[model samples]
Target: MEFAGCSRGSSGRALALAICLLALISLSCAARLSASSRQKLDVHKHLNRLNKPAVKSIKSPDGDIIDCVHISQQPAFDHPYLKDHKIQMRPTYHPEGLFAENKVAESTKERVNTQLWHVNGRCPEDTIPVRRTKEDDILRASSMKHYGRKKQRTIPKSADPDLANESGHQHAIAYVNGDKYYGAKATINVWEPKIQQPNEFSLSQLWVLGGSFGEDLNSIEAGWQVSPDLYGDNNTRLFTYWTSDAYQATGCYNLLCSGFIQINNEIAMGASISPVSGVRGSQYDISILVWKDPKEGHWWMQFGNDYVLGYWPSYLFSYLADSASMVEWGGEVVNSEPDGQHTSTQMGSGRFPEEGFGKASYFRNIQVVDSSNNLKAPKGLGTFTEQPNCYDVRTGSNGDWGHYFYYGGPGKNSNCP
Candidate 1:
């Protein structure tokens, strides 16, 4: 009876093992059915994607039909502006980052070639070659529109026909005594200096024209006037500069601190003369300041010496922010007196809270640098600073005007030839 019981127990154990195996097989079959159903669903979803309008066709290397239609859920070129645009895929030559260090060479052929179009940045000839396509025109059109209507529309004659005929370039168009002209002018001053405040001064970061800039009430035609009646004072010397014309306001006084030259108003890469005590104004180069900005494709203001002061992006406006459309070359003073009475409202004056350090001065040369030519230096006014030229020519015995006398130097030795 004991042997029979043991044998029955072993048989029962075997039967339990077989049941477990069958149960595992059944679970596996159910899992495989679930996986199959999932795969079918995925295939159905892909088929539904084929009906989308965004995708046009899909081609295979072996010339076999893949999905040939849009299988993507998101539509390409769905934007309202790009509804009519089409999408295409083709092998393209993109910089692999490995060859980026190498300088690309320019092609001798002017016509578009496969090799030339595929070339990348900064070729040996210093030109970037791009694949010629309709995209180029599109890019140009987009850029032209970026400046808005002001930049796109042509100028309509609003003034007299004679005046409009006299007007040439819209930029750097200088007017001297209500006359348009281009040249360099310089001047020297001899007067009593005033005592300045301990720390009162202003600094202008000129990104445009440079070379002696300041307001001199004693002299007119060059100094910038904040008001029609107001002029720089000698008593407080609040709204005045001596070194360069540009300055920063420190309260009610004008600080004759130095200005900085920046490249495109972004990169600081050049030197500037800072305002100091008894810093006698001299021929400071404004050319570098103008050239720096021009390198970034913009023109800067030139100073009394016909040198660039610095570049200002907003100078492109026909109307200046101050409503002063013209750049004055000399100084404008109240009653043409150094100790003139200050009466005009202080529009743009400031003073140092601590002490007086700076005063206003004058500016002379005014010219624009032509940036179209990519030369390293400024194109106009070859000299960095122009010497004093005679403004008041005296008629000689020979009936010819002496140009040298007006320049403040000794008259020319040679008679008029």
Candidate 2:
């Protein structure tokens, strides 16, 4: 009987231990599930904070992440509807349903009155006009809000060979006619050049303009850096631009990118372009646009050929109240150290050196459009049916628009006077 009792006691202890182990495991799983739920809720709350009702969470077909937003049809201050009259606002009967279709966030709607009427130069009858305004006041205001300024970086002449070209390699040219000032177009011929020192300088640059001596440079759209910044400032090449699928690399870098000016790394708006591991200089003849949106503290970079290069969002711009005094073009290095350990990108690499690595690229026709005319005409580079919007503002093909041409040396023809 004693032996039996002892055996029974041992069995009971083993069963109790097993039960405890199972209970611990179950409790651990529950805790994990609770944490996951909390994390998800936190993410949702943050997104809601953006207060953009137009945004919709979507799962990409390939399981990638993609979000969609509805374009608002309601006219803002600068739309054609508001061009002729002053705008005033009044509350609507059904505040919740007012912007239902447009999907503007609830928070945004609440901030401003539901019924707002925009006006032309004069104030609407009900509202008083402010002092010192013009017909183009709205446009000018928007431009200032969108395009601020650029940080300046004056490069020493001996920094990088490609960037420090003593022969005046770095340059910017634009049409000078007055009417063309708001909009201008010019045809430039790009010639391919044989690669010299094939690795150090790939003949690519960011175009800068302040009218050769002014204090502003236009941003390059869809720009990307590929080579690693190994020797620090010794390399001066930024590569690869494309407009479409068949339009591979620019064939050669001898055209507009013989040399480019370097300025402070301040960008009004910009994009990054990257080449794959095996691809080199396959696309060519590309155009880009940079614009600002005041409400959003971000600059935009657009890419395309005479036809189409999509717009990729880059959040690397700070708004400047003053105009950009300088524009930077090439990727010449001034130091031999790595550009700090840069963060990795899903798009591509920014470590490329102009002549050090593989093949690179070129750029041209750098121009600066003031806030007064940022949206009056397209930058003239994208794909537009009846001449580019840039050229649309032009009077015609010949001398109607002021023209600046950068022709490659020797056998190349610039197609300009």
Candidate 3:
């Protein structure tokens, strides 16, 4: 679900002065607290509204669910962290498989499948609406003694902050790093699964990160998610999030923040995606690329074969101002077991990778941008699963796919539950 950023070192005296300066400067900008101190902030005050029944759920004319809670877009001038940041729409640069001939002004939803959310993915005038599920994610986690399955597990301050362990109930993932990475690319399959709760979601994504996870992690993420609170449907949708400091206040869903500039009119970050092969097929896949524009100092995201969406301005990040130190890809699912049983919702497809190629879901053509700005296959690909019976990953090499892997499994099974 998220990458725990790598750490950095600086001179003790210099670091002290920098922290003081950063605090003074960030008080008027985005002042980030150390990870330990950050969690102590009064998060309850910010999330209390989540329980209000006033926040109603409604349906769009197209029948898509809308958890009508619109998080007001913070004014650019008001964001202490990312103030007056650059946000814009650029000309479309078709990615690899996207054909200009098949290009449509609107998404395939208008022609091939049902249109959900905003027809063109446009939110209200200045308000950026996100899946109500995001709110649920925050509230649900906060309501618990332990953080929700995903968020609590990510922070080292939590009881089981270790991402490498096998206790399962993962908000878990695998990564490659120890160097300054520029970007990461992966082609991930999209699947819609049966969700058990309004707050539960199943996702598989790529995380390109700079800085360490504790206090100074900056990240750019993209992938497919079946999150009802956010999208209000069982249809898996393409989604993205960017943060200058961490996932807390600086970043949000797709264009929810005034940070990620959207250029492609054809694809919307959280809009429902109608995979060409449908949820049950092995053919549906989308290649995602996130790279830094060395010349412009901006981070860009490219989708599929053609749609080169907008970017996150460099000023919005610290480590990402130049390059990332780590890259991660894999699946994450919420184990919202009310009665202490595993959730039935699935990750990728509800099937095991042991089911074989066509029957199982996968990520292929995985690559990363080297410091030289080359799209090269990743080195040292590794896999991690919290529960072997609940989920698993198998890696392989082939000329066509490069560093690729097949991963997925039902959340509920005799051994898992």
Candidate 4:
């Protein structure tokens, strides 16, 4: 009888342990489900904030949805400072010595570039086109807050080569310093350079800089870029970026944030540009001009000769509220150096500057806006490259093209390794 009682006791203990284990498993699965629910809710809330109610929507061939949001209801007004801000319809003054773009030679006129979305439809006169953000776009980011924002320390620090190298960003640039600048202009050659990794990107841009190259740097950038991680494709797109505090918390790409106000209803930021340049083929390019309005103190951006896109409010910056200390123009590529070797991503045309002309990428007719609101050629222009063997730059000038440079190269050459 005593032996039988012991067996019963042992069975009782075993049953209790089994019950306890089952309870723990249930709790864990419930917790996981709750966490996943919270993430979905957060993503939806963010999408609601960014994608305002659209009066009309157009679907582009490239799988983009363009929402025509009312001007007053645009994202810029979401900022506390812009809550009561009055939109400036036009700049108080345009810089003199504008390029005669209409007089381009007939041979080069075949290189016209346009946004891919134009083939579908146009936004209404009183609305601005915004590229609608999708759930996958948010999920692709490391986090919701970092979506549509650049990683920190991406700028090329010309004064500190060591710091530039540590940042993993390579550049072939022409820069001007030692004087206050109001703005900058460049005609950038556009090409869809092959990106080896989704996280890496290639771009040709002009940087208008203020303050030192440290934590307090201010910058306004506009250019053409091919970033698969950012846009989920290899198509070259027109993009703009600004930062009042060196890209920490103050800015975002295009209109993903609430700082830059878009006044024009035609061109949509973040849309793909068609007719990219090909090697030894007809070359295509885009002209970007970013200048500060002397009277209003706001920074204005003009794309090509027709579209005066919009402006960054004077309140959005500190040092740039007055003038820029430096201007840089050229190509930059993110070199992640996968597998302990240089990446195979291409910058610009992915050909050395020595190739020249249609075979290489070039920035021509570079200019800077002076304090007197005049556009003039930069003085004492200097070039910089982190790894000359992997990428390089060469500058030249003439009566027709003014000041220009051919720059870029394949990243993972034998010498680069």
Candidate 5:
């Protein structure tokens, strides 16, 4: 009878323990569900903030939704300082000595680049096109708050070789410093470079930099890129980035943040550009010009020859408010190979600068705006690359192309590894 009693006690205790375990599991699941629910709510709230009301919506072939938001209601006005900002419809001063289009026409066999969204519909005059941010777009980010932001310390510093290697970013760039630059212009050769991983990207751009390359640096960037992580696709897209504090919290890519004011109803900031350059085929490039207004001190960007895209108000920057101290133009790629192997991602045309012409990507007509607001060939152009075996840059000048450089390469080869 005592043995029977002991057995009963043991069974009862076991059953109670089982019940306790089940209860804890249920509570844990409930907590997870609650947290997930809150996260969904926050994501929706962010989407609501970013995807402004549209006067019209056009679906592009590339699966992008372009929303025609009223110019006054753009995300730019969200900044507290810009609450009373009057939009500068046009730049007060235009840089002189723009490279003649006839020169490009006579030299290379090129095609015109257009945004995919233009095939469907057009936004009205008083509205600007904005790429609609979907829930999946935000969810693809490491976190909701970090969506559309470059990782910290992504920009290359010529002085800090160690920092560039640590950041996993490699560049083949042509830079000019030691002068007060008001603007920069480059006709960047665009390609849909293959990204080895979703987290990696390849781009060709121009950088207007100010201050030291430290935490307090200010930069304005414009170019074309293929970022699978940011856009959730492998399409080449037009992008712009700015950071008043070295990419920590100051800015975001394209129209993802509350800064650059867009006055043009055309050219969606994050939309895909079609007809990327092909191997040994017709080449395509886009001319990007970023300059500061001498009068208002606002920085302006012009796409191609026309299409004055927008401006970053003078107050958005500290060092750039006066002028840029340096300018860099060329290709950069993120090498995120986990196995210590070089990434196979391609930068620019994925062909080394030695390939030349249609076989390699090139930045032609590279010019910087002088203190007098006139665009002229940059002097003392210097090139830098972390690993020349992986990628490289070679510069040249001619009457037809002005100051030009052929750059980029396939990221990983026997030598690079």
Candidate 6:
């Protein structure tokens, strides 16, 4: 009888242990679900982010991990211009959505390629790009709210902790034509840079301006950069920025501002353009041309051949409203290296331009829009650098590339720092 009682006691203890194990497992699962529910990625309260069909998330050039969402209407700022046009959520020929209808048949034939966007300063579609302020997806960028603690400040935005909210673009640019600028064009290669700080990045791009480089500067900037400090991953992407008064209160990187508008979603400023880019020696570099319409007085930005993203309106700038005074093209790097050793942060490919073609990085066929709105090879080109040992430029003109140059060097070179 005693033996029988002991067996019953043992069984009771075993049952209690199992129940405890089950409870612990349930608690763990619930904790995971709760944490996931609290940590939502899309911080922009746009309605399109809710309960949408499962879409792939891509890394933005600046480093934010964003889920792709669709919009059928223009942002509130572009409402006036988009009133007459139907919104296009996907590219006509590209395939990424259930709504994407391929309109063109793929060609397998060999073909000759020519320049895109004849210097007429006309947008492919009749519509132009616009920007937004106060409330926009890109405004809440760095909504991961800055990864950790405070580190450094480049321009004293002591209160705004979000990297994007700060002076987002701290560039090391090369300039030409200080007062004779109309428009500028260049082809830039994209590369993923090593990012040490959330606010720092590396890229190759073009900056066209009209006013002085001081607080009154009016400019248009476009390029490709890898900013993990901003986006999340080091995915290189196309980017654009414009401001009537420097970068103070009027403009933003990509569509974060209220003046630039988008008609095609196939290739966007912040979206990953990786599938068709990044491979060297494959005729895959991005050709960007920003020219002003002498008649309409609008600045138009064009990408490659088929994609004309859109334009920034004339009334958007005080200085650029008339004409650009200067033009610039080259590589930029923001180094927030904490250990103080040069941030392995590369500007172009992290390789020296002396390495050449597939081995290094370069910009070819650099041109500018003349008064007649034609793409003309640059004349009397001159270059500038903040630090020659870390980054440099070499320009030349030829029958093939017209006027082009090779630039960029790894930060913290053996001879630099």
TM-score pick, better of 5 and 6: 5
CA lDDT, candidate 5, residue 50: 91
Which tens-of-lDDT digit does each residue in 1-417 have in candidate 5? Answer: 233223457677677667778989999999999999999999999999898999999999989999999999999988889999999899898888764655674555447688999999999999999999999899899997789998888887765677767679999999999989999999888899999899899999999999987888999999999998889999999999999999989899998989999999989898899888899888887889999988989999999877899999989999999999999999989998788899899999899999899899999889999989899899999999999999999999998789999999999998899
Candidate scoring better on lDDT of 1 and 5: 5
Find the 10 residues in a row with the least total lDDT in model 1: 401-410
Residue 372 of model 5, lDDT score: 90
Error of 3 at 200 (Å): 1.1
Q: How far is candidate 5 from the true structure (C-alpha RMSD, Å)?
A: 2.6
Model 5 clash pairs are: none
lDDT of 2 by residue, 1-417 (tens): 233223457677677667778889999999999987875565455334322332333332222122222223111222233334321121111111112212322222322211011111112222211111112322222232221111132221222334433221222112222122211111111113322221222222333222222122123322332222211222222232211111121111111111111111111111111212222433233333443323332233333211111111112211122233333332221111124321111111122212211232223334444445332222343111111110111122212212222211111112210
**Model 6: residue 196 alpha-carbon error in angstroms:** 3.5
Q: Against the true structure, candidate 1 has what lDDT?
A: 0.21
lDDT against true structure, model 5: 0.90
Specify the poorest-scoring 10-residue window by lDDT in model 2: 383-392
The lDDT of each candidate is: 0.21, 0.25, 0.61, 0.90, 0.90, 0.56
- List model 3 lDDT by residue over 1-417, tens digit each: 221232244455566666767768877554455643554443443334222222444444445444433233322323455554544545322223323213321333222322255443444332333333343344445343322223422421112245533223453355677777777888776667667777777788898887776557787888888876555557677788777665544666664435665545445456677633444343566768888776676788888656676677778898899888788887877766777787777777777776756667777777788777777777776666767688777788786666777777887889887
Error of 2 at 149 (Å): 22
lDDT (0-100) at residue 144 of candidate 4?
92
Q: Per-prediction TM-score, please?
A: 0.21, 0.30, 0.67, 0.95, 0.96, 0.65
Residue 76 accuracy (lDDT) in model 1 = 24
Pairs clashing within candidate 4: none
Model 1 lDDT tens row, 144-185: 222111111111112222332111201011122222121122
Off by over 4 Å in 1: 1-192, 195-261, 264-297, 301-309, 315-325, 333-417
Cα displacement (angstroms), candidate 1, residue 240, comes to 12
**lDDT for 87 (candidate 4):** 94
For candidate 4, the per-residue lDDT at 113 reads 87
Model 5 poorest ten-residue lDDT run: 1-10
Candidate topping TM-score: 5
